[model samples]
Target: MSGLNDRILGLGLLVLAVAYGWVAQQWPEPFGGSEGLGPETFPTILSVVLVIGSLYLMVKPDADAQWPWGKTALELLVAVIVLVIYALLLEPLGFVISTTLVVGTLSWRMGASPGKAFLTGLISAVVVFGLFNYGLSLSLPAGLLEIN
Candidate 1:
């Protein structure tokens, strides 16, 4: 039963991986002859990783795996909801704020204290924002925090 479930999940994920890789390939050529990694690089890499992982799952699944129940299932649902809301809010609230909200909520739900969770989220969001915006030259949406 678990093997069948794993195979089904793997097949679904494999389809998603292929689609994601294809979409990544559709990105327009970067301005400067593609000297550095472009927007598609990360997604392509992620899709490849997902494909490998899905294949592994399909090939060898855990025989004793059990599905989440009750509170565990509810927690998973909440996590998914948080991720969806985060995506919707990203452009409006900006990367830092949206990431903070999502990360803090998940951290708190995972048993961290509210204060610690929020602080961690804030620090992490800031660090990631700085890294992507400055170091990687990838501009995350500033939205409400726009400097202009």
Candidate 2:
């Protein structure tokens, strides 16, 4: 049963990796022609790694694996739901707000106090947002907090 579960998960991840790689390849060439490290490079690399890892899982699953039940399973389900909702709200709430909420929820689930979790989320969101926007010269959607 565990082997079957691993194979099924591997197959699903393999499909996702292929689709992600394909989408990465579909990006248009940058102006002044394709050059070093375009937008697709990182995702394409990650998808390739995912493909390899998934294939390995399919080939060699863990011998002693157990599926979660009861509270643990419920917690996993809650995490997934939170992540999905975070994705849905990211564009509307913006990266900082959405990330803060998601991180705070996940951190609290992992045993941190609610206040500390939210503060951590806020700090992390700001740092990463700064890194991407200023250091990397990429813009995340400002959404409701748009300055202009």
> Which residue runs does candidate 1 get wrong by more than 4 Å?
none
On TM-score, the candidate that comes out on top is 1
What's the TM-score of every candidate structure? 0.95, 0.89
Shift in Å, residue 45, candidate 1: 1.7
What is candidate 1's lDDT per residue for 1-148, written digit by digit as tens?
6688889889999999999999999989888787477788778999999999999989998788899999999999999999999999999999999999999999999999999999999999999999888887778999799987
Per-residue lDDT, model 2, residue 59, is 97
Q: How well does model 1 score by local distance difference test? A: 0.93
Lowest lDDT 10-mer window, candidate 1?
A: 33-42
Clash count per candidate: 0, 0
Q: Please give the lDDT score at residue 1 for candidate 2.
A: 64
Tally clashes: model 2.
0
Flag clash pairs in model 1: none
Q: Candidate 1: deviation at residue 4, Å? A: 0.5
